[model samples]
Target: GRALGEDYEVRAAATAEEGLAAVEADPEAVDLVLLDIRMPGRDGFWLLDRLREGFPNLPVVMVTAYGDTETAIEAMKRGAYDYLVKPFDVAHVRALIEAARKQRALTRSAVSLEPDAPSPGDRIIGNSPAMVEVYKRIGQIAATTLPCLITGETGTGKELVARALVQYGPRAEKPFLVVDCAAIPKDLLESELFGYEEGAFTGARKGGKLGKFELAHGGTLFLDEIAEIPLALQSKLLRVLQDGTFQRVGGTEEIRADVRVIAATCADLEARVAAGAFRADLFYRINVGRIHLPPLRERRGDIPALVRYFVQKHGAAVGRPVTGVSEDLLRALQARPWPGNVRELENEIRRLLASTRGEVLAAEIPPACPGEDAACGELRSLAARALEEGGEGAFHRFVARAEASLIAEALERTGGNVSAAARLLGITRLTLRKKAEEYGIRVPDPDA
Candidate 1:
């Protein structure tokens, strides 16, 4: 304890039983533990296994003179913070303890403050019934290796869901490789994924490059915009999924990857399959489990929590001390439909922090998007009429129809190009498409 620094407080336990007692008595009192693998009566492995069930967060550093690679790997698998070969340097032990403390601090900070609400790290932020269901589904599926297909609008945090699954699941320590199918060039994506040998293609790196599958072995491989992957490559990806075997672009030697595939897309994949733009077989392979992130407008109840999260995150990033958001500003925020979802909200917060000074955030509030403001106004008008008309369903249908018609007309004017229509309507393409589909309106063809 004294060797490290005055900042650390250490307690030594004589026996495994006593150590377990001490830990159970006051879980928060201990920071790092030096557990000997060969202890009297109950061995270190047994103790380690028991401690994991009760205090998984506690950092246990194993100490053994007869340690082997298998023992080290097993300790890690059993959640040992780190292992020390016996007669190890005092400084090394101190360093490992310090690192464990830092990791624990980060984990604690990620939990949300509100006791009743789900913590930020628990799942995606939202309180709607749909969101609650999503969280439940995530918990149920996190333990399995089944492929998950995340479907949502562009800014609806599909990647966030994927990351959360990896972070909170069994393969948390393993690699989490992301392949942006839409961003990478079609010609080079295959090589990037399956890797290439020195002579596989022109300008190939010497030796052989490890593909994403190899890099993400025994972990997750997230394929974002999976629908954008070229049809020819889809067959290759399918073969890997079927046999977990693939050869480098130029090499004939087969390599097996034990990876969990999580694919995501913003496109209507079923429609794309019908159009022959995507492989129907690949779709079925990756769709064993699915999670659809609802667009922000559909779950406006989450706006407050999301806004607070972004404000705090960006405020710290920009070195500003931000006070709580104003009630009027929050009302305005909740009133506006966030087309870009969590991502757009984060960007807006960064912009606010960059432009404004002082603790109060009202001064940094940007003008509401024109479409959102208009929608809010119409809702208010409808609400007033509904109050007067004794809450008639006809009025509700009328408002819904009007909103749908307005969106459909805007999409039509843009020639069914969802992105262009989103730009024209001052909304996100994800939000626009969702609204269009909800209203049963035909999405215009870009060619037309």
Candidate 2:
């Protein structure tokens, strides 16, 4: 049970003392520690505090018999990566381990958050000149407290650039908050950015609420989709930027704001300004330290690295282990035009990892059919076949023949490994077996 299926190097400690000793002997030996709360001598909470102070970046998973909402919240605040109740399954523990490892890996990566990185974009994965320029720009911006504007196509990772500025900059030690101007309702956005006094508006919380600007007083506020901010609210935003001061929604006292703003937009703010939708002055102010991210298609060399990262990241977390990815799969990934950019690629890998039952293959990836839905490729082929050989029930014969051929091919290639074949055909193993029986298909045994 402790082996975590052989992929992880599990270290056992009968007691908290032994665990602490193991950690102390080689402080960096453990990537994740699963400490039980009911251990003899000092409890897990005490050990948690010690480990947190000693290795601040270490991911810890706390297991406890006394699970509750308050306990869970407290454990999280104490820097526990995740918590498992007494009766939790081993699968849950494995998932938590994956999450922890991914978290730790992201923390150590130099590109976005690594302070004192040796070279420009040292942590970023790509060596493309465009990416290299972005890295250099990020380093330059990180040296000062200038308001930065990051512009890119949707899903090009604008937030990542914003994060790099904060993590490698003077504001590294302070809180960094984000507000999506497009996601939140415009009517409530002002109050959300700036606090509102009690009874100032209906549905307002008791006492008052501290806004993102006030909460991020000594840190950074990342405003995503800056172009979406309503024209009426832009004046207030301008005033805040102008003198670093703003009042509550219904109050007269001006709150002296002292927060740095990093704005991002996928839209052309200059076009918006010219169209009289966005404030020109605010656009220019935030545009001081600018960084534009290239779409994934323009950075094709980075695709392989990103795919590996996502596969490892999601496979571990979701418990769908893939031994390796086929070269054919890599080629399929590289050839596509990712309209959704890096975010799309990450989601695709994650979805593939979650669905695959064994080694990932080229057949598992969605085919790149131009001007047609990948899901309907088979249907399109069948339709064309029906047109080629027209007769009564020709469509029915085509569907049945195609289905039988697909099932036969999948079983043949997998050596009758039902689960693997099922994954390849994107169906359940039981469904495949039933279909084989219905079609009287002869599936060969592995040792035949």
Candidate 3:
């Protein structure tokens, strides 16, 4: 308590029963709990359950001896906020307390979908018909432990839906862990998910580490970019989903973890299966409870609400507190095709807030395509002339010319950055490069 300084008021309890009683008596007064696992009478686990039942939002950090880190980890899987090993650094404890406080606050805030509602923290913030359908699906399956698969275009809030599932489910009190399969290298992903025994391979730790599966036992595990999981690893994942059992890499013992798995992907798994890149059976297993999120372009009616939410959220964040958005600004936002969806809209809001000077946000809306304002007139004239000439391949030729022009403009806008241009053009970098080459357009070296 002294180590945490005068900023925190510490309350100590002699026994597990006494601690639970104190919290039950005045739950609102307590922000954090540090319980020793070996407390006399009823044990920490018993007290942990009592605490969870009463105050699922409260953060509890388990205290353990040097060799009991595994038990501490087990405690975390079973709803403890974190653990402190004996003789732990005072600074580390302080950091853990701070983090737990922040997370607890966020969990308690909950996600709100009220249109144009001002929130000081995180909220879902959409009320269009498509978004309403999305919410309905979330409400329907969030309470069940069904294996859920969230499919959407990138930046369409797939992870947000996944978190909502964890928040509303019976395992809300337990740990919620996320793994991005695409971010991890393919070679290491197997061991990353399943763990490995000591001496399993070169440079293995003396005490084999626990994998996310074991760590997330009795809770939720969110696997983003699910389609990126390699074919060989798919079978192992299928086994766990089938029987809730898996062995550590290179280990004989079969370990079991009761985890609710939620997966998200932007890729079309049906195409992957057709191409023989993904297993058909595995796809069907995860597809049992699927939720597809509509892209932002399909739900432009929700743009005002989204813009309002982002303005309030990012305005204070950027230290430029604008009173409100202009009608002109809102219309301009709704006019563009947000290829990157909500994520892109939020980024643009942040960019505007960084340089915004006035009380009301009003800025020039750039053309969707660079130089589009200047070229639209000429393009219309060309189209009319092509129609008058009535050539057999005129339509195809016009489309090719327009596509080439857009590709060149996107590249120019991004200063020859192929990846950025591809994102702007709503196509893959590979496709952009092929089109650029076919059109005899030169792009700067990627390394440059």
Best by lDDT: 3
Residue 408 CA displacement from its true place in model 1, Å: 18
In candidate 1, the residue pairs with backbone N, CA or C atoms under 3 Å apart (3 or more residues apart, or in different chains) clash, namely 416-444
Would you list the rank order by TM-score, best first? 3, 1, 2
Q: Which stretches of candidate 2 lie over 4 Å from their true place?
A: 1-124, 318-320, 360-363, 372-448
Write the residue-wise lDDT of candidate 2 on 1-448 in tens digits.
4558477887788888888899999876688898898887888888899998877667788988888998899898887767899888877677566656544544446223221223333234554546655665675577568788999876678888888788777898999998987556678999999989998999888998889999999899999978768778898998887889999998889898788999998666775564345678988788888999987878897777666666655556566455567787888899887766777787788777766667663346776666754335435434543453454667665576467557766766676677898999999877887876654454444456
Residues 1-448 of candidate 1: C-alpha lDDT, one tens digit per residue: 4665565666777678888998999987777678999877888888898787777656788889986999999998887777889778887676566556544443344335342333344235655545644554565456678899999866778887888777657898999999987556678999889999887888888886989999999999999988767777889999999889998898899999999999998667776664445678899999998999887778887777777777765566667577667777677777666655666666676787777667766753666645565356445433443343343465655465456546755655665677877898899877876776554454645467
lDDT (tens digit, per residue) of candidate 3 on 138-224: 655776798999998767888898887787668999999999885566778888999999988898888897898999999999999
The Cα local distance difference test for each model comes to: 0.72, 0.74, 0.76
Model 2 residue pairs with clashes: 111-123
Error of 3 at 24 (Å): 39
The Cα RMSD in angstroms, rounded to one decimal, for candidate 2 relative to the true structure is: 25.3
Output the better candidate (1/3) by lDDT.
3
Residue 447: error of model 2 in Å?
86
